[model samples]
Every structure is written in C-alpha cells, then in structure tokens.
Target: MTPQTQPAPAPSPTQATAGTRRGRRPSLGAVALYPATFLALLVVAWFAVTTTGLVQPYIIPSPVDTWKAFTDNPEYLWGHTLVTTGETLAGFVIAAVVGVLVAVLMVYSPTLEKTFYPLILFAQVIPKIAIAPLFVVWLGFGASPKVLVAVLMAFFPVVISGISGLRSVDPELLELTSTMGASRIKTFWKVRFPAALPELLSGLKVAATLAVTGAVVGEFVGANSGLGFVILQANGNIDTAMLFAALIIMSALGVLLFAIIQVAETLLIPWHASRRNRG
Candidate 1:
C-alpha cells in the first residue's frame, strides 16, 4: 500500500502578514493618485465659485489673484517664511530633547512620575495661547516668545508618547535580559529604545506641526517678521489675495516639517511592522 502524503503545514501569522504586505504594496503613482484627484477637485470647485461670483473676490480671491500676490513680492514673503521656519525648528529641537529626557526620568522613577505627571497634565490643559502673551512679556516681542510657545506646544505630546513607549516593554523580556547578566543600560539601549521608537516618532510628527502653529500664534501676538506678520498686515489692508498666499505658505511649512519627520521614521524604524506594512 502507498503511504498517504503528509499534509502541508499552514502558514504562520507572521508569514501570512508578510505575504499580505508584499501583495498590497502600492506603486508610487497609485499612492499619489488619491491626493492628486482630491486636489484637482478642490481647484475645480474654487474656480467655479470664484468665476461664477458665488463667492466674492474680496472674501475669497481667485487663484490668479493669489498667484499674483506671491509673484509681486516673492522676496518679502520668502524672508518672512524663513524667519518662521527657523523659530519652528529651534523650538521643536528643544522640546524633543527635553521631552525625551523628562520621559526617561519619569519612567525610571515612580516617585517622579507620580509627582510630576499630574502637574504636566495640568499644564497641558491650560491653553498655550493664553500663556503665550506671558512669554512675550517675559521674553520680549522677538523670536524668543515664538520659539518658547512652540516648545510648549510640542513638549507635552513627546513626553506622553515617550512614557507610553518606555512602559510598554515586556517584563518577561526585561527579566530575561537581567538573567543573562545584561546591564540595565545595555538592555535599554538594545531593546527598550528600539521598542519605543514607533510611538516616539508618531508623537514627533504631531509635535512638528504644532510647533509651526505655535510660532505663527506667537507672531500673531507680536512679531516684526514671519508669515503671521504678513497675514496680519494683509488682513488690515484688506489684501485678500496676499492673506491667502501667506496662509498657503504657512500650511506648506507645517506640511514640510511633518514630511521630514515621516522620512525620518521610515529611515529609523524600517524594521517595525508599521513601516513594513507601508512598504
């Protein structure tokens, strides 16, 4: 009698997931098509409304008018954009460094976490805009206040995400590392930090955008230069086209910062499941 052939083994979940990712990987053009389509629709709607006089030109300038505003004084706008960008970057860097360090400290010390977490939450709840003027008063009407506001806007999310990530390490894995005679620092560096990166990077992306808003808000309070200043000037003079142009530039700056963080996440955590799935 011929022996029955052995049955094939089922694919493991990991193998199945890997196969799914490979199958679902999107082409560059496919990935871009959705946003491009949406943007085109928006442009069509905008043109229709403006050309048909459904929306007043004073309230919502035509695309041509906005383009003219940019072309008219490109250098003036560029200088202000650079000023805002610098403030945003400076604040974001400071917030990131301080936030991570604070998170590490709180994680390592239960007493510190217990004492400071509530206070942190309280501070977070207070409107940063309300306190922004105070910073302006203290730091003066310069980049200092804008950067400070940005730091405040960005700091909380980083700290919260850092705490979540740091605490998520498996106790069993930690014990195993300890049993292997690994130092706490070695385990943390090799295992804990790597595990924490996905959450940390997510927080950074949010913080990056908030930092831009904070800079603009501070500029609104009092600024000689920046997109916010340009917007304020255009608003007072009823230059709707220039106002729209400044708003667009401000939005672009925030998007640019967010995209940079996304690129960083891709580079730093290519091994993570999120990154793998995206790929």
Candidate 2:
C-alpha cells in the first residue's frame, strides 16, 4: 500500500485576515515601539525646555524637581494617594452595581423605562460640581462625600451602555428562547446578559477613569487629604514641582485602573471581538 499523507487544516477567518495584512500592517512590536519612542522624545523635550530655562521653574518645574518632590516626602504623597485610591474603588464598585441593576430593570419593564429613563437623563445633566458640596454637607466632610461624587460622575455611562447592550439582543433569539420554555430570568442570565457584556465592559472602563476624576474633584472642593488636596496646597505655596508630582500620580492611577478593566474584559470575555482583534 502507498503511504498516505493527511492534508493540512484550512486557516480560520482570523488567521487568513491576519496573513493578508501581515505585510501591510505594522507588527505589534513596531506599533508599541513608536509610542514608546514618542513618549521618550516628549520627556526629553520637557527636560530640555525646563533645564534650558525656556520655561520658568515656577511655571513649569523641571522633571528632576518633580522627582525630588516625591522622593523628599514619600509618606505624605503615598498616604494621600492611598486615600484617593480607596475612595475611587469604593465609588466605582457602587456605581457598577447600581448601574447594572437599573439597566436590567429598564430593559425588563417598559413602565420603568418610560418613568425612570428620562429622570436618569435629567440627573446626568445636573452638574456634579454643583452637587458635590451638598454631599459633603449631608454626609459630612469624610470619604462619603468623595465616594458619592465619584458615583454621580461614573454612574450614567455604565447605565446607558448596559441598557443598550441588554436591549441589543435579537428579538428573534429572545422569542426562540421563550419557545424553548426558558424562564425570563433564565433567558436574561443565559442569553441577554452575555450578549451585553462587551458594551457593559466598555462603559465600566469609562466609569473607572471618571471615578478617579470624581474623587479628585471632591478632594479639591472639600477634603484636606488626597492628591487633589496636595495639588491645591502646592499651588498655594508655589510648589510647582510638588503639584506636578501629584498630577503625575493621579494620571498614573487612572491609567492603572483603566488597564485593570481592560484585563478584566479580556479574562471575562476572551472570545469578544475586541479581545480577538487585539490578539
């Protein structure tokens, strides 16, 4: 008998598409390299501008001075950073729970949607800055106010995206699920919720970053602690370097939280188009 050879499996759609673009598209490392190089150049320009006295030190502190600010007083900055992080995490968690619950209620009940959806939109339009003080008054000058402010800032996006996601389920699929004798709760959990994960996660990622801003805003308005307070104090004292350091820390915190959400999205829904595209 003649020896037989097994044929190779056909490439998948993703593989074929990737192959087609391999020559045209920049490699992942190249894409990353460009950003890294750009950032390095930016830092070099910043250092040059400050060191060469192109900008006044009081106006734009040198990067070395900014580094010194953190090194000289690590305890002060680190403590405030931890406090801000805690408030942000607390507010984000609360917003996620409330937003998802509200989305589910609106999706399931037309009455609730008709009555409450407009109200929710109205609430979003009301400036959180105008209301941040009220929370401080009602909840006292504590973490409560900061957390509430963060919640207000982050809540709407999650609710809106979640509602869209849940409602995006194909009506035909829902009908089929009903015909198959699945209960409403079962259908939602098994089909609708999963279908909505991508949009919901996108909203959460936005909310996560907003939560940081909200926390800082609350601290700016009232709190005596946190990076926001540090910035405020630095401004009053003309400590531009310290102010820059605080700002840098806040930006890093937001980036860290957003990155965490991205990781969670990948882990939770590896099959999502966004995750697959990244791959």
Candidate 3:
C-alpha cells in the first residue's frame, strides 16, 4: 500500500535566523568604503607624482600648492564662486520650469511634438560655445548671457526626459482612472505626475552637471568674474596651482549640485525602485 508522504517541517528558529543572517545586505558604511578607498589611493598617487618631481610643479601643481593658492586669495575666489553658483542655479530653475511646461504641451498634442522635437534636436546640435559669444554681444558681458547659456544647456535634457516620463503612464491605469470619472487634470496630478518623477529627476541630474559647464563656458567667452575667468587668468600668468584650485572648486560645485538633485529624488519618491534598491 502506497502511503502519503508527510510535508517537510517548517524551519526551526535557529535555522531561520541563520538564513536571515546569510541574506543580509551590506551596510551603508560598507558600501561607501570602496569609493573612499579609491579616492584615498588617487590622492596618494597625486601627492607622489608631484612630491617626487615626476611632473614639474609648473605643469602639475602639488595638492599643498593648490591649497595655498586658495588661501592666498580667499575673497577673490569666494566672490567668483558665488557668481558662478548663482548663474548655475538660475539656469537650472528656468530649465526645469519652462522645459516641463513645454513637455506637457507636447505630450498632449502630437503635432507639437513632431514640430518642436526636431527643432530642439537642431538647437542641441549647434555648439553652444560657438554661439555663446553671440549672446555676450546681445546681452553684454554681464551675468545675463551666462545665465542664458546655462538655461540653454540644461533645457534639452529636461524637455526630453519630461516628455518621456509624462507619457510613460500605463495605459490601462490611465483607463482605470478615466472609468472612475476623474478629470484629466486630476488624473495627471494623482497618477501621471507621480509616475513621471523618477525619469524627470534622472534628467535633472544630467542637467545639473551640464549647467555648471554651461556657466563656465559663458564665463570663458566673456566674464569679469567666475572660476572660468580665474582659470583663464591663471593660465595667462602660468599659475598652474591657481588653475588647479579653480578646477577643483568647479568639480566640487558640480558634484554638490548633483548630490542635491539626488537628495530631492530620494525625498520626493522614496517608493521608487531606484531608491528602494539603494536602501
């Protein structure tokens, strides 16, 4: 006679505890260690290259020299940093606002998308630097041209990503909302806008970095102040250490802006898959 086999017994508390331990993810500090280690190694290599005279001081200044350059002209550097920062911030805000509105209009109207998308692509293709001087001529050497350059640099990414995000809502979900007799505007705010935030944030991160570049480019073309101007002056004077210091500040600025966007993304969409994965 065939006998029915008994089901396997549930795991014991001790076995379940061991399984949980084995499946545990690395802590945040542990995850951060890898980048910290690499950065430390890079700094060590930089110091060695300069201190050992492998590269001339004039060509590649030591970290100590770069630090001294900043200390030597604190006010000058601080003022220029503020100017560039303002330009970058203004450009980013304008891009985010105008780009999103344009994206919404385009998404709701196919004809607008077809008409403007190619024009945007065309504008993006033209070298911003080449036309930056024209803006200087139009708006003068003041901050307006620089801010405009930043806006142009940041605008494309926002519009592209905004359009993509706004249209990516699940059609079935949209239909479900429609069946519930929700107004189009109500459906958009409650469903589409929230659904599109992740993609929009992704674009904003890219635009943030590019905004720095745009501001610097505008300064390069014509500016009485800014990190770009400092770099240019340092190059003219053959002050490699000062140039390096300005470059370091610019890099830090870009990184800081990008980090701000990432924080906003986390706060705004804690439920997004990207944030969940990081957690």
Candidate 4:
C-alpha cells in the first residue's frame, strides 16, 4: 500500500516573502481597467439614447456636453466646493469635542445624564429641514449657520456612541481595578476609556456622513455661496451638468474625510478587534 502523507506545509520563509512582495506592489493597470470599462459603457449608452431624439438635449445632456460645461466654468464650481468643505470640517471638529465631553459626563454622573438626556432625545426628533430656515434667520447668510447646522446633524451619533462605549466597562475589570486600589478617574483613564474606543470610532464614521448632509442643507437655506447654493442657482438656470459636478465634488470630499478618520482609527487602535479584522 502507498504511504499516506499530510499535505505540504505552507511555503518556506523565502518563497513566502517573495509571494507577499508581489501581492503588495500596487498594480495601476488592474486598478484602471474596470472603471474605464464602466465609464465607456455609460458614455455609449447615454449617447445612443440622446442622439436617438428619445429625449430633448436640455432634459438629458450628452456626456460630451456635460464635459464642456464642467471644463468651461470649473473655477466657479471649485470656489463653492471650498466653502462647503470648510463648513463641514469646522462643524465636525466642534461636534467631536462637545459630543465626547457630554458622553463622558453622562457616563460618570447619573444625575447629569438624567437632567439633559430627555431634552437631547427630544431635540433629535425635530425635523432638520424645518430647522434650516430658522438657522438662516437666526445666523444669517454666512458660515455660522452652515457650521451650526452641520454640528447639530453630526453631534448625535458621537454622543450616542460615546455613551455606549464609556459605560461598557466590564464589571470584572472594574472590580480588578478597585482591588488594586485605583481611583475612579485613574481606572477610567487607564482601563475604561481604552475599552470604549472601538465603539466611539464606529459612531464617528456615521457622524462624518451626516455632517456633509448638514452643511449642504445649511447652504440650501440662505447662502449666496457653497455647493448647496450652487445647486439652487444651477437648477434655476437649468445647468444640470454643473449641478451634478458640484454634487460629485461634495461626495468626494465626504469620502476623503471619512477615509482619513478611518485610517486614524486603524493606527490608534490596532489592538482593537475591529481593526484586527480589518487587517
């Protein structure tokens, strides 16, 4: 009878090293192939429909025509993009600061939590769009209103996540810290806060997306500048291509900001379970 044998072991060290190096090197052609294919398909489909006279030119501009619009007045769109991005970043920072502090306080002091928790929940249910006009009236057609609106929209997620994180300390860990004669503040800083980090980061990601929406809403209400204002102006004049371009830019900005946050989270919490899974 032939001798039974186990499967070969994973490659020895030198071969494994070579395999990893090949995999790690970024491939430009591979990255570009699929997106270019899809883009070509989209253009062909759009041209076919528009050229067939099935739709009016103004109702659905061809890809070539949209390109012309984008190239012709890029400066105008870029200026408004800057304004929207600035407001989003500002409001996001404020929300992060205040949300963390409030959540921490709530976690530590039941009285403080009970006092404002109901009011905070009530405020969250109020319609954001309805408050848009009020923000414009109170803060006027400036950056303040846009920033505040963004802050309001993004703050809740951070607060909600932070509370859950701060309070999720294991009872066993708490008892261990107590047996070691650690003070409450010391135990919190050394043990509790670190445990909560993964949840807080997940919440931050949600807040980042909402923050962009808030800035746009703020612009829609009364601003003379910004992506939202640009959309309104473009719609009034029926400049659909520019409107779409502005929206695309806003989407890119949001994605970039959120990506940065995710990268930071990965770096700061490498030992956390989610980060390990991501790796």
Best candidate per TM-score, number?
Answer: 1
- TM-score for each of the candidates: 0.90, 0.89, 0.89, 0.82
Question: Once model 1 is optimally superposed onto the true structure by TM-score, how far is the C-alpha of residue 26 displaced, in angstroms?
Answer: 2.5
Clashes of 4: 0
TM-score of 3: 0.89
Across 1-279, the per-residue lDDT of candidate 2 in tens digits comes to: 855577766778787666442245456587579879998998999999999999999999998999999999999999999999999999999999999999999988999999999999998999888888888889887898999999988999999999999988889999899789988889989999999999999999999999999999888889889888999999999999999999999999998999899779867876677666653
Global local distance difference test of model 4: 0.85
lDDT of each: 0.91, 0.90, 0.91, 0.85
- List clashing residue pairs in candidate 3: none
| lDDT winner | 3
For residue 195, model 1's alpha carbon misses the true position, in angstroms, by: 0.6
Worst 10 residues of 2 by lDDT: 19-28
Error of 3 at 79 (Å): 0.7
How close to the true structure is residue 18 of candidate 4, measured as C-alpha lDDT?
Answer: 62
Tens digits of lDDT, candidate 1, 101-164:
9999999999999999999888888898899889988999889999999998999999999989
Off by over 4 Å in 4: 1-53
Over 1-279, each residue of candidate 3 has an lDDT whose tens digit, in order, gives: 857598777788887566342244467599679999999999899999999999999999998999999999899999999999999999999989999999999999999989999998998888999999999999999999999999999999999999999988899999899789989999989999999999999999999999999999999999989988999999999999999989989999999999899879868986777666653
Candidate 4 local lDDT, residue 58: 70
